[model samples]
Target: MIRTLVISISSLFLCLFFTACVRDTDFDQAEDISLSPIMELDLIYFNLQASDFYDTINGTPILTLRDTTEIKFLDDSTLQESLKRADFYFKFTNSIPRSFQVDFEFLSEENNITYETGTAVEQGEVSTPVITEFTHIVEGEAISQLTLANKVVVSVTIPSSNENLQGTLNMKSKTTYFLEY
Candidate 1:
């Protein structure tokens, strides 16, 4: 009888302890949950420069414009294609008075990728790449990168007879990037 009484008391106490810990207070309040989801947008701006015309940029043109290609992190959607700028240019001062056409190419490892500037370029835009002759080079190449989500581009120019041309030309380039978000 003693043992039975002790076990019953302990069990009863345990039951009450657990039960008391689970009491619900009825405050009667409505829930105001927010439905909008939050997302991260990392916009990495890159100050682009024309390091080299032949091998440096020619080999990996897209990598040259690495900053402009990082526009895919604005939303929740995964990046299937990389965004690119098309209004690329170069500025040059020709020693001799001559007329020549300059160009550039943005090559990416990915397939079917293209680059195109959504809007037109203005004159004397600094900090960013302006499609000009010497910005990249005006000797033989015709243009530099100027497009979005593109792969390859080619600028063509002929030799000048007298003085070399000196100015800036806003050209386009091809860039192929993949969205992995």
Candidate 2:
């Protein structure tokens, strides 16, 4: 008798489970989905001493110093397609007594300049450091030119320098990217 009762209940539950209603799912809604992500990355940093701008052997000052850094990720096809906007930030801490000009040149693989920007750093004393900040935003048509760059050249220009020049000039920079797909 117990066995028959157990079998009856099991049959009834199975019948009810199979008869439950579920709403229809529309897979086409997935087509309207999109993703947007923002990313920030460190671009470059450098520290230069006063002596770096002076030529000890030649007994003259080197007015400018340039450094090149590869930015190959900007050339990626995926990044080029999804990147909607980009912003570059540079911060300069100057303890040197001479004002300077800093330039950023974005170049393509063929050494062509795609974009160029710069900032002027104010003169400061060794006892008191001066901070200067600069921002460059690329959107709309400018984004196209930025995507073509595979390298960046940084040039620091000083007005004058001597063996007795004292203090340092430091820089920190970063880039923020906005992407949508």
Candidate 3:
């Protein structure tokens, strides 16, 4: 009889202890919850350069710009939206009067995709050297949906001329990530 009484007392004490340990929570009152959602945004930039036009192959002068560059975007698993925009700037100084055509091609190494952006023509008819600048903006959907790690192949074609032209290329990209919880 004593053993039975002890076991009953112990079982009641355990039930009471477990019941007190579990606190009732009202999920309807969400404001009282300690955890909350958050939102975030970010912007990123990139650049590229080419500086030599003095080399010639097979006695033929070459002035085409071929460069490989790296870039970073958001991961695919991240539940966020992003937009990528880019601006390509080319600056050159001509030593003599001449007319030239510029063409651009961009390739993505991650996806093996190629994009033929644009082409421009400029004429320098002055006797003195002059500095010229050209700009191209990239706003394509294919480029905006890039992976976190990527490479961009830049190809520029400029016909060779008797006049010498020294130039530099720069690319600036902006990535805007919109994250909401």
Candidate 4:
């Protein structure tokens, strides 16, 4: 009986020792994630023709325009621009009966940048999207910025002949960049 008890205790100690020495190869600290949400989206006209119809932009009626642009990030904090205007298209039915507003957090910057291809990230790229939506009354078009660590989603709550709002438009590239200080 005593020999059996000693064997059992030794086995328990061996098990504990093995567990303590085990290495967690799969365990890792969570890396920082940057999600930029495009807020302050406006539903208005672009230059001459609306963005919805500029390219092969034909769809169900939509309330918002058809152009979408999001900056790419070098890291979670800094961002870089690859394309100035990302081609975005939206379509909707003329049957919806409710109105809606969209909001996205943007990067913080003092000035709003005018979009140009091969240009540096604009000030607005650092801002969050303001709350804006399409109504019976169309207004000037504006989408401020995409916030870090936020995913921007667009929705149309209105329905009309101009209802060319497209499906979910995501950023073409990761805008936020990181550089060790």
Candidate 5:
């Protein structure tokens, strides 16, 4: 009876020791990632007639255009982890001179956060191209899980004018995601 009790206690201790030594299969890791993506919309046109000025189409105001595009980040699994913060930048360029008001909204469904920014380019020399850039940083608890499905919406408004507004807009986004384990 004494030998059996001793053996049982030793086996229990050995089990506990092995269990304590086991490493976690999943663990958090902190990594910094930078992504650069470019998108272009060609042959964009905005024309508002005098008669249609009072009319609203699909809840959008007259002479206003809106576009929503998905923004990519780290891989799905990596994005599923916690994202401590991110620094975002956008570089906008046009093939021809354009006078319009533009706004950008970055939306994250998981976090229910929107980062909004905008810029306006007044009438410039037609012979010269226009380039605009802006940056936005999100830190602290504002940043949540970032995924590929995140959206970036672009809105442009062109006031009533006799001449039609037309140009190709190119957008480039650079993002640095700081992930936490």
Candidate 6:
């Protein structure tokens, strides 16, 4: 008699479980879902010694130095479509006792400049390093221009440099992207 009672209880519970799972679930609500993701990534970094700006053979001081980095990720169609805005942050630590002008140029595959921005760095010494921070925001029509860039060219210019100059200049930078889909 106990065995029969157990079987009957089990059957009733199974029927109730099946009935509960039959409730209607809305699938159409998924169409209204939206996603917004913010991503930050390192863009560039470099360290420069004072000697790098001096010409050993010519015995002259170089006033400018330039570096270029490819940014192929910006060419992705999906990313271009989803990206709404971008913010670029650059920090410079200067121990060289000379002021600097730094320029960032976004370039296309054909070497045409798509966008450009710049900042000024104050003079500092090894005893006291000067920290300079810069931010560039891209929105509105500028977003389209930024998306077309496939390379970034950085140019650093110093007002005065000498072979005997001491200390170093360092730069760290990052970019933040805001996307909605």
lDDT of 5 at 116: 64
Tens digits of per-residue lDDT, candidate 5, 1-181, equal: 9999999999999989888864665434323344433322221223222233224445333666677666654325565465656677666565434466778666765534356667774543435546776666766744543343367677866565333334455556666666654
What TM-score should be assigned to candidate 6?
0.83
Candidate 5: list runs displaced more than 4 Å: 1-62, 72-81, 95-97, 108-113, 145-149, 164-167
Model 5: clashing residue pairs? none
Worst 10 residues of 2 by lDDT: 19-28
lDDT of 2 by residue, 1-181 (tens): 9999999999899988998766697778899777899999999999999999999999999999999999999978888888999999999999999999999899999999998889899997999999999998989988888889999999999999999999999999999999988
Instruction: Estimate the Cα RMSD of every predicted model relative to the unseen true structure.
Output: 13.4, 3.4, 9.0, 16.9, 10.7, 4.2
Clashing pairs in 2: none
Ranking by TM-score: 2, 6, 5, 3, 1, 4
**Residues 1-181, model 3: lDDT tens digits:** 9999999999999988888753586767776544323323322222222224445344444566566655433333433133344445556554333444444433344455555544443544345545556655545564443433355555545555322444333333333332332
Give one digit per residue, the lDDT tens place, for model 6 in 1-181.
9999999999899988887763577878799787989999999999999888899889998999999999999867887788899999999999999989999999989999999999999898988999999999998889888888889999999887788998889999999999988
TM-scores of all candidate predictions against the true structure: 0.23, 0.85, 0.42, 0.23, 0.49, 0.83
lDDT of 6: 0.91
- Residue 17's lDDT within candidate 3 is 85
Please give the clash total of every predicted structure, in order.
51, 0, 0, 43, 0, 0
TM-score of 1: 0.23
> Could you give me the TM-score of model 2 versus the true structure?
0.85
TM-score of 4: 0.23
- State each model's CA lDDT, in order: 0.32, 0.93, 0.46, 0.30, 0.55, 0.91
Model 3 regions lying over 4 Å from their true place: 1-51, 54-58, 74-80, 84-104, 124-149, 162-181
- Candidate 5 global TM-score: 0.49
Give the Cα RMSD of candidate 6.
4.2
lDDT of 4 at 42: 31
Q: How accurate is candidate 2 locally (lDDT)?
A: 0.93
Q: After superposition, how far is residue 30 of candidate 3 from its true place, in Å?
A: 12
Summing lDDT over every window of 10 consecutive residues in candidate 5, give the lowest-scoring window. Answer: 39-48
